[model samples]
Target chain A: MFIQQLINGLTLGSIYALIALGYTMVYGVLLMINFAHSEIFMIGAYIGLWALTAIPAFASFTITGFIITFLVVLLFSGLLAVSVEKLAYKPLRQAPRLSPLISAIGVSIVLQNLIMLFVSNQSMPLPEFKTTRYQIFSAEVDTLQIFIFCFSIALMLLLNLFISKTKFGKAMRATAHSHSVSQLMGINSSSMIAMVFFIGGALGGIAGMLNGMYYGSIKYNMGFFPGIKAFTAAVLGGIGNVKGAMLGGFLLGLIETFSAGYISSQNKDVITFCVLILMLVFKPTGILGENVTEKV
Target chain B: MYKLISVLFLGLILIAGCAKQDKNVIKVALAGPLTGDIAAMGQGMKKAIEIAVEEANQSGVLKDKKFQAVIFDDRADPKEAVSVANQIVSDPQIYGIVGHLNSGCSIPASQIYAKYNLVIITPASTNPKLTQQGLKNVFRVCTTDDVQGSAAANYVIDKLKIKNVSIIHDKTPYGQGIAENFKATFENRKDKVLSYDGINTGDKDFKALLTKIKTFKPQLIYFGGVYSEYGLLSKQAKELGLNAVFFSDDGSSSPEYIKIAGSASEGNYVSMIGIPPAKLKKAKAFLDTFASKYPGTDLQPYDTYTYETSKILIDAIVKTNMDKSKIADYLATVKFDGILGITSFDANGDTLNKSISIYKAKNGKFEYCE
Candidate 1:
């Protein structure tokens, strides 16, 4: 039972971690929480759905078709995220932090309504994927679960490599420390910010696709809770720390699952939130988070 | 100066005269979670009322008098519901109301509606407390959770011959109410309910619950909640290798469930009031009209209820003399032949007789079992 919950928690947490990475990355660079990040996730699912359903080449759920559909969704979602940043957030970057936050909210509302207008407000069902099961010790797991877990880990590892072993990653870290200093250090600050959003959006898109595949449906408003939870995960993991987000995601998922099991299931959200609050109150910097001294 | 004086004098007279005429349009307020997690249900309720008014006007109902529907979206929040109720009561044109879907929303909102003498006919609100309060104006077209809960329990035990059962709920009024009802009925029949638990509506992880359910070795599991959780629960249960048959109430009757649960939705049973759209004779025409109007969008479970509620309201209006007070009296006596079945309000304004249907998901489609 514990192992099963851990697997379930890890699967859910990884998705939240993927989404949280976007939120934390953008925040690290721009100092603005991209409220519209959730909408990007929503749009990704819709784009994938449209591709799978409307595009003749991508109609089947074959591995090749799925891969093609995934790439298309990622590309479209990345472009959508970049456009939103350029139109909504870029103009207000120099303004007060609150201004960008408000604009992000506006962008969120706009994207949600726009999606509702284009895709029916109703939930769109995904085409059924073939199911294959494997038994591990006492646990029986399906192919889908294994796929989600492996995919999320692979994506995170790729992200880690891109951040640690790449020039752009160093620029992103420099920007996170101080944007003005990064600008002086010859980093194209605005473009870096845009790149941050692009990467975040791409990951978000993948998460959305995985979510749609896992849940077998997606809706216009499906992003809200997951977005909030991912944000919570990021905050719990130390907002600017990428690895922190992953840890927080899995931890929160486990807490929610077990609480639903032993405690009241209805109190799952309350338990998750309470854990978040406790962590913030005590550890402050999260499990793998760096403890930054506050300048008075 | 002479032109200005005449314009001001005419505006004053027009404002006073228009106010009196505005009172003539009988406004029926329909409040629901029009834009939230359960917005689909709210939208269905609102659309049904609109269709009812259009049909009523065309049929020369209420002696050629046009009835207007005042809509307010509560977003399915209880606090918002109270404020919407207040807004409804302040408008004198609103002689009647048609919603406030969830029981949590309805309980607070209905108190205000009751105090204001507003006749409320909830098309889909099924919490027993909504009508059990003995509020004169409060009524519902669908049966309560008590009836639904018992029916589900009886079916599982007597029909399926399931001995040990695990029950789960979202812990909201609707979820917990139905769960309790099922638990009571199952216990009464000397059947063992292995475990009863509650889960948050928004939380998706249910592997732990499934794990515990697996240990209990129950043949059946009952969930009293909406489709959002139902889909996740079904998928997660299958993933955790729990093979117990899942059963749910009307809340899980939407096509979205199959979408969320995928092939795991197959063979799961859902009991709901009224027949599925595929089985309903009247539903075919509605579907044709809806498909033509909306195009490609499928109808939700409450769509038929909304259509029937609207028909009943308009039928009552047609029987009345265009007087708001008289219409409420007429509604109590109205024998409405609607899309679902013949509906008539008893003395307490509750529907006299209604039937429930059990549907099974087969190959990603909902098939009527009986």
Candidate 2:
């Protein structure tokens, strides 16, 4: 039972990591929390649902089908993120902090309602992706769990390489440190900002699609709670730090599933948020957050 | 500034002047969850009421009065139900109301209806407290959860011969009320309940809870919740190899439940307060007419009750002077044998001779189990 719970935790955690990376990446680059990223996750999930329903060859579970779904969701989400940043966030780039925050919230509402109006408000049971369970060490683990863990890890590693080993990655880091400084260093800061939004959106989108596949259901407001939890993961790991976000997502997921299994199932959500509150209060800089002086 | 103010004042006057009123129109409101998870049930009820009204209007029940069906989507929320109740009450043209399904919504909204002397006949809400609150303005065509719960318990314990039964509710009034009633019946009969628990509405994940239930090794898992929650619960339980015989309440008697739960829902039982639509011999013509008129709408059990309720209200309006108190008084004493096999309400506004029909899921459909 405990091992089974851990598998559930790992599957849930990896999805959270996918979304948390988005929140962390956006905060990393623009020093702005893209609140609408969760809605982008929802859009991706809807797209994944439609895709599943449309494709006859991918009716049941296959690794190739899953890969196709992930890639499709990733591309669409990246494009959506870039478009959102260009239209809503860029206009308020020089405004007060509250202004951009309000704009992000507006974007979130518009996206959620638009989907509600066009698609359905009910929970859509995504087309089944069947997999056989294997008995291992007094526990049963399924192919879906294994796939989620590996896929999330692979994406995270790919993202790490992109950020560290590529010129675009260096520009993103440099911009995060100080936007004007990176601009002076000949980086097209606007396009760099858009790129950061795209990557964050893409990761969050894939996370949403993965979430639909994992749970077998998706609703209009499905992203709200996971979005808050992922944001909590971002904060717990260190808001501006990508590595911290990944660690925080897994830790939170494990904590949630174990507590639900061992403790009260109804109060699992309460316990999760309590952990977030305690971490926020005790370690404000998060596990990997570094202190930096203001450049005023 | 003076010219702009004059323009705004003229626009307000124009809006006020355009408010249309027809003296011969008799409006009856139908409020329920037109959107959200349980939308299919609400929409089914709506179509039945609309059909009932259209037939009556064409037949000239009131001779000169033309009936208009006013619909409102309360989304099965208590707060929204109250707001909808208030909205319909404020509309003086509305003669009666047919619903606000889901007892959680109907119970709260019933208070506001009583205050304004508005008549509301709920077709599907089964919570016992709804009619027991002594609200004369409120009536229901279906049996209460107390009756339903007892029937289901008797069927499970005595007939099915299930001993170690587990009870789970969705924590809402509709879910929790029926669950409590089921537990009460079990306690009276001295039947063993292995475990009793609750889950929140909108909860899709049930693996953690299912894993916990596995330790108990319950012979029967009786869930008092709607289809959306139970669909996931049953599927997850199957996935975890719990292997318990599943029993659900009327809340999960829909074909959608089987579709959502897939192969896992096969051979499960669902107990509803009334006989299954397929079994109602008197309702076959009504069902055929409904299906022919509305090509795609599934003729569900609640649609029968809604059809009966609409006919009753229309019949009452034809006799009464379009007064709320008169209609209420008439409804209390009225006896009719229509779609639901001799419909009549007791002093508490609950239907007399309540019967619970059991259904078994097979081949992605709910089949009546006689």
Candidate 3:
């Protein structure tokens, strides 16, 4: 039972980690939280739905259609995220930090209303994905759970590779460490920021797709709860630390599942939040986060 | 320019005066949770009312009179319900109301509706206290939690012959009331209630309660909660390797539960008011019409109720000679054969006879349990 909950927690945590990456990545470079990231996540789910419904190839392939639909949705979502940053976030980059944050909130509201205008506020039906369960000594696990955990780990590994091996990744790290120094080093900080948003948005899109598939339905406002939880996960793992966000997501997911199982199921949210509050009060740097010293 | 402006202003005044004098149209207000967690029910209700109004208008039951339904989305909040009620009351054209879905919202909103002397027929609000206030204007088409609770308890005790049961509630007015009523009914039948507890609505975990429940070795667990918590509870219970009959109330009517819990929802029973969409003959027609009108939308619970409420309201309006003052009196005596069933308001304007249907999840579908 414990192992089963652990697996379920990890699967859920992976999706949160994917979303949290978007938040932490953007914050790492811009020092601004994109409040509209949740909306981006929501749009991704809609795009996935649209792709599945509109594409003839995907429509006919009932069993394997979801995987194809997910990829198409992820691509579109990444493009949308990049475009949003270029149009909405880029113009306000030179302005005060508060300006971008406010604009992000405005963008979030607009996207939500736009969804309401187009999609019925009702929950959309998800294309069925058959999941086979494998029982192992009092624990029954499903294929979807394994897929989620493996896919998330692979994405994170690839992301780590991109950040470490690629020029853009180095530029991002440099920009995060010191923007002026990175600029002096001839890195295009603005373009790097855009790239960060693109990467984060792509991962967020994947997370959105996985969430819809896992939950078997999607709502226009579904992004709010999971997005907030992912943000909390990012903070828990260690904001600005790539590995920390992943750790935080899994940790939170495990904590939530266990809490739901052993503690009062009704107070699961309370328990999760309490853990976050305790962490913040005690170990502010988080499990994998480095304690930073400010020299004035 | 000034002379033209003066002429335009005079024309507007004349039009306004003429519009005010014309009493050919009557408006009915529909208030419910349209944009929150329970937004689906509100939307279903709204769609039903829309269809009912359209059918009534087409039927031309009221000679030379038009009926309009003004919808107010309360988002299931009591505070918003009051504001919505006030808005509905201020509108002189509105003769009747058909909403405030949640009991918490309905209880407070009913006062304002009653004070304004507007007859409010709730299609979905099922709390007993909603009508027990003895408010003349407040009427409900659906049976209250009292009937539903007793029905579920009786089923568990008589049919299932379950000796030990665990009762869990979501801690809301509807959930807690249903739980308490069920507990009383079960206790009355000499059935042992192994455990009784309350949980928050949005809670995702149930292992602790399940652990306790497992230890108690109850044959059945009755959850008085909405679909959201029930889905997770069902899933977690299965994951924890606990096999027991899980039952929920009307709030778990949504197909979303099956989607969320997957195979885990199998064998779980949900007792709900009115016939499920699959069983209602008129519901099929409504579904067809709704599908054609609003394509690619999932059918939701309370859609038939809303349709019936609107039909009843229109029937009352037509019978009352289009007089807003007499509409409430007419509604009290009106018998409406609507999409759900033949709905008639008693002295308290509550539906006289209503049946609760039990649906069991089987093979990833909600199959009607006989």
Candidate 4:
């Protein structure tokens, strides 16, 4: 029981970490939380639902087909994030910091309602994927859990490499350090911001697709709770620190799972938040602490 | 300016005077969660009331007056239901209310309606305390959870011969009430209850909870919640290899549950308040009328009850000349013969129709078993 719950927690933690990276990236680059990012995640799940059910090419549940669908969803989600940044957040970039945050919220509500109006407000089932379970010393682990864990870990590693080694990533880090100064040094801060949003949204979309596959269902507002939790994870790791967001996401997922498994399911959420509060009070800088130039 | 003020005052007086004499439209409020996850049930209730009102108006039941339905969305939340009840009471044109699908919502909303002496005829709420509050103006056309829960317990104990069981509830008044009643009855029969747990309504992840339950290795598991949570529980239970028999109450007696649970829903037992519509000969007319009026739409479990509740409220209004208190009095003694059979209210305002039927999920649908 303990081993199975730990596996479940790790799977959930991977999803939260993927989503938290999005929040941390956006905050790192633009210094503003993209509240609508959750809705972007929701849209990706809907797209996955549509593709698997409506499109014949992606109808079957094969590993290759699933990867193709993820890639397609990732691209669309990234572009959608860019558009949201341009339309909602870009205009308010020069205004008060609070204005963009409020605008992001407005964008979130608009996206949620639009999906409700166009798609559906009710929960819709995703096609089931029968997973094979392996028993290891009286504990069971499924193929889907292993896949999610590995996929998310690979993506995080890739993201880490890109930020540390790539030129575009250096420009983004420079932009985060001083937006005006980066522009003076021939870096297009606007494009860098858009790129950060694209990367964040892409990660969120993958997380959304994984979540839908894990749960076997999707709804218009399915992203709300996960979005809030990922935000908590990002904060716990350190708002602008990439590595910290990943660490916090896993820690929060483990805490929620163990508390729910051992203590009580009803109090898991309460305990998760309590841990966040404690972390904020004692280690306000977070586990990894915010980076200066490498905020992205 | 003085002439304008005087003319405006005259216009206001004319409007108030017209309001006093304009009693041709008799309105009743239908409140429920019309826009959320449970909107399927809410929309079905709306359709049932609309059909009842259409039939009543066509028959000229009120002589010169016509029936009108004023609808509000409570989102199945108790707080929203209370505000909806207050809104309905503020409108003097509304003669009565036929609403509030969830027992949690109905219980709170009924208190507000009772304060204003406005009659509320609930079509679906089954918590015993809804009527046990002794609110004279509150009545229901469906049976209570105490009756439904005990009937389910009897079936599990006598028919299935299940000895040890585990129970879970959504923690709302309706879910918790039914769960407690089931536990009480099961324990009275000296059967072992392995465990009892509570889950939040909108939670999707239940692997941890199910993993914990798997340790008990019970014979059956009973869930006291609506389809939204129960369906997920069913799916997750299968994923975790917890092969216990799944049992639930009327809350999971919807097509949505089958859809959400998919193949995992097979062989699960669910109990509903009344007989299945297809099997009940008395429901033929109601079903036919609904089909003819709203093609390609599904009738929720509560639709028949809501339709009956609407008819009873309309009948009471016709019998009492739209006097709210008199309508309440009429409902208490009224013997309504409708889709659910002869329905009348006890002193506590609970329905006399205590029959419940069980169904098993076969293939992809809930087939009537009893």
How would you encode candidate 4's per-residue C-alpha lDDT over B1-370 as one tens digit per residue?
A: 9999999999999999897557798998899888877888998999999988999999998888999988899999888888888888998888999989999899889999888899999989989888888789999877789998889999999999999999999988899899999999999999999999888877778888888988999999999989988889998888788899999999789988988898999999999998788877888888999999899887788998888889888988998887776888888899987777898888988887878999999999898888
> TM-score: which candidate is best?
4
In model 3, which residue pairs have backbone atoms overlapping below 3 Å? A260-B205, A260-B206, A260-B207, A261-B207, A261-B208, A262-B208, A265-B205
- Backbone clash pairs for candidate 2 read none
Quality class of the docking in candidate 3, CAPRI style: incorrect
Clashing pairs in 1: A265-B198, A265-B199, A265-B200, A266-B198, A266-B199, A266-B200
Error of 4 at A17 (Å): 1.2
Judging by DockQ against the true structure, name the best candidate.
4
TM-score of each: 0.90, 0.93, 0.84, 0.95
Q: Mind giving the per-residue lDDT tens digits that candidate 2 earns over A196-215?
A: 88899998898888888777
In order, the Cα lDDT scores of the candidates are 0.81, 0.84, 0.81, 0.89
Cα displacement (angstroms), candidate 2, residue B236, comes to 1.1
A-chain TM-score, model 4 = 0.97
lDDT of 4 by residue, A1-296 (tens): 99988887899899999999999999988889989989988998988787777768778777787778888889999999999999999988889999999999999999999998898878888898878988866667788889999999999999999988999989988998889999999999999999999999999988998998888888888888899999999999998899988998998889988888888877778888999899889988788874665788
**DockQ, all candidates in order:** 0.48, 0.47, 0.23, 0.62
In candidate 2, what are the lDDT values of residues B298-329, reduced to their tens digit?
66658888888888888877778787669888
Worst window of 10 by summed lDDT in candidate 1 chain B: B314-323
Q: Could you give candidate 1's per-residue lDDT for residues B1-370 as a string of tens digits?
A: 9999999999999999886567447777788888766677777777767777766676766664578887999987889999999998987777678887788888888889888777788877887878878777777898889889999998998888888999999888988999999999999989898888887676556777788788888898999999888988998788777899999999888887887787789899999886676677876777676667667666777877777776766556556654566766677777777677678877766787667888899987888887
TM-score of 4: 0.95
Model 4 regions more than 4 Å off: B1-22
10 residues in a row with least lDDT, candidate 2 chain A: A287-296
